[model samples]
Target: MAQVLEFRLPDLGEGLTEAEIVRWLVEVGDVVAVDQPVVEVETAKAMVDVPCPYAGVVTARFGEEGSELPVGSPLITVAVGAPASDPDSDAGTEGSGNVLVGYGTTEAPARRRRVRREQQVPVPVNGRSAAPEVVEGPVPVISPLVRRLARENGLDLRELTGSGPDGLILRADVEYALRAAASPGRPAPALTPETTVASPATASPTPAGTRVPLKGVRGAVADKLSRSRSEIPDATCWVDADATELMRARAAMNGAGGPKISLLALLARICTAALARFPELNSTVDTAAREIVRLDAVHLGFAAQTERGLVVPVVKDAHARDAESLSAEFARLTEAARTGTLTPAELTGGTFTLNNYGVFGVDGSTPIINHPEAAMLGVGRIIPKPWVHEGELAVRQVVQLSLTFDHRVCDGGTAGGFLRYVADCVEQPAVLLRTL
Candidate 1:
């Protein structure tokens, strides 16, 4: 007898609570193997392929693509121990012990069966066959947020027909039902094309502008920046430095180099050295304990803007990496960020951040510090400018360096010293050689 087992969205770690379904790999009646990736989802942190622990025939899927589902919501149901549609295959009953965080099984299953796609009747519960009369199973809903909204308004989801794909109830459906119930005699207004379920307030007539839901990478960035502004007492210090020497040193190194080094890598190398000198900036504040937590290792994070949104990929043990190594790691991480392949582990745990907004062709910016990190170094475009070099006014390559530091961690003196050190390294690349 086949036993149907429900598989919910597993916790992708990094304190994530929900994920948006990007794509589904398996369909109804398709045989699945233990620990096989069944779906790809995008969370606040990164894109993750969710694997199913059970090996069996997929009976049903709960959500549509692009719909947000809270953690632990049913993703799919599998009929374990079910006979495969293919005569040559057999559905395994045991679950795979290998699983993601917040989900796992006790033992590994036997050899996986060959996956075959065929529509099959849903298996009944407790070894009972389906009755002659059509029986409705659980309500078709994916998002817990939608369920909560319906529950709060005392609305019955089963009574309302869902407008989303696969008859999945959406937040807009609940809101529309609530509005229709509130006014008994009045006819409910037609939903326009621009109507969005992002919030109940926005589920009305078409607005003048388009409403983009901030639930993915954009939402994460917004939340982090807002929290950083509200919680951190931050201060910014800026300085214009002559980067002519730095550029010349880079050209010289590349000209004679085995492997070319990137300018961002040079800046990162300088940052690690500066952090070594000023360890105060390489720490985070423990607000709960009212103590400053100085980090021993420098997990350097560099900001990279991608099609998805702004992301900061961290390089582990950055202090121990040389310029070439930093260049390679930065390149790899930037590629991952651009392609949306960065893992949750790659996107977090940074003691300091380096923002190269110069690529945006900007001269300067007061960057908001990445939360939990004490400081961020922003580099502006290096352009030709008049400077007093060797007591002569000449056109020299100049770049603006800005440091935004948490005032709770250190005073202006410490921040200013750190900024000055970075600027000195930028002005005279040889200044970094001492630490190198």
Candidate 2:
């Protein structure tokens, strides 16, 4: 006997409640395999592909295309019979839904949204648009959203294929086409020194002097920040550090294979190492649980400033890696952040965070802790100045470090010691070599 099993939306990331269904990967009557892309949901951070948990013919779609659904809501149905118990397992047969326990599992349908299906046109392999690609078997294809973007932008899916697995068209392809169109007859925009002017070639030089409406990531960041600042009691501490040795060491190590090590990498490595000595700083204050949850690993967050807003992508287990490894990982995370390519894992699980405003030539800044995490380290630009050396005046490169911590969970002494530890590592680069 055949049985129909319902699949529900899973938690895309920590603390994520709901997501908008950007598009459906499979429709009613379509056959789908377990772990196949069944839907694409857009959360505040990024667009995530929701995979099928059960293998069977798609009996019904729970939510309509372009509708927001809460986590654990029925997403689709699959038929399971003489099959593997674990649906997410890579067994020959697609088993019951692989919805992970605890994070969330789909239950019976709560309420149904009006379903809508968009026409999908498939481009033939011969580089022509003949007929829609009729998806057969269990292989997932381009989502309806990507197809719609292709149509709206006059982008021939044949001209540019997908970088996604199994040749599936992705949102990136559509965005790339849009960017190319916008840059026509204009010089490719480069990052300018001034944040006041974003993409100098795109906008008029004359200031619009008009307030823009908030939406999307910008709106979300603004709302979240407002709540964090107004509701949470935050405290900050500042320390001036001598970074002369670090600057020289980084320049000397530039001839290596890794990504050009950045100052942020240096600071992150120091902070991670310091956390091992002071595990109390590597913790989160769980308000609901009324406990300070101390984490074992050092998952450092990089406070990346993008055109959309600030996004902190966590680099898991930074303490386990070396300086060069940390540098390469930091580069990868920030690049993904700017290009909007970060996955759910990369965007969450931050035990501590670092924000670099020193690049902007700012001497020091009190940055807000990315929250839950007890502390955030902000580094300023390195500038040459006169200092005491061997009882004589000398010019040395110095940078300021600002540390913000949750006073509710930590005292001034703990915060001070953490800052001093970072300062010692920055002042003497050789200290890190000894620890590593």
Cα lDDT listed for each candidate: 0.82, 0.70
C-alpha-based local distance difference test score of model 2: 0.70
Which regions of candidate 1 deviate over 4 angstroms? 87-90, 101-207
Clashes of 1: 0
How many Å off is the CA of 139 in candidate 2? 18
Model 1 lDDT tens row, 234-264 = 9999999999999999999899959899999
Best-fitting candidate, scored by lDDT: 1
Residue pairs with clashing backbones, model 2: 53-97, 122-132, 358-380, 358-381
Off by over 4 Å in 2: 1-6, 27-29, 59-66, 77-96, 100-227, 256-261, 277-279, 286-295, 306-308, 335-343, 359-361, 383-396, 433-436
lDDT of 1 at 403: 96
